[model samples]
Target: MRTNSFTLLRQMVESGMGIGIVFGRFLQVRRESIAFVELRDLPFASPPVACCRMAGRTPTVSSEAFAAAIKTIFHNYGG
Candidate 1:
């Protein structure tokens, strides 16, 4: 069930095997078989996400360099 493929996820959801939540920004009108429900007024707050880094361990040289570059990119992009 773990995948980064949107097409696979959408196909799975449409096949009635499971449900998937595609963000509004990513949803397209290509599939009439799939239904979308907009969720609102949740009891919890949902905040936007930034890059993620591993916790509680020393990062490898490559990882640290990658994180620094990604952080710089995010900084340049301004959130």
Candidate 2:
């Protein structure tokens, strides 16, 4: 089964629907029903992320600031 909702995916995993492969960030805490495994041997790649706004729409001050902040973070991290 495929789902777009993270909450639903987590619920299914916890309920023994099947094993779920997810990012380590999602498994922040230990759960009794779920065993966590880290596949360190696998190659790690960061997914491309975008900070986008609607085309032809005027940007708000807050939106510009947010984009600047995102740019600053990536620059600082050498992304």
TM-score of each: 0.45, 0.41
Q: After best superposition, candidate 1 residue 30: deviation in angstroms?
A: 2.1
Q: Which ten residues in a row have the lowest lDDT in candidate 1?
A: 48-57
Root-mean-square deviation of every model: 13.1, 14.7
lDDT of 1 by residue, 1-79 (tens): 6767877866676665645544333445663465554444333345433222222345578756875675576566654
lDDT of each: 0.52, 0.51
Q: How well is each residue in 2-74 modelled by candidate 2, as lDDT tens digits?
A: 7667677667767755544454445335434444443332223544332222234466787568656755765
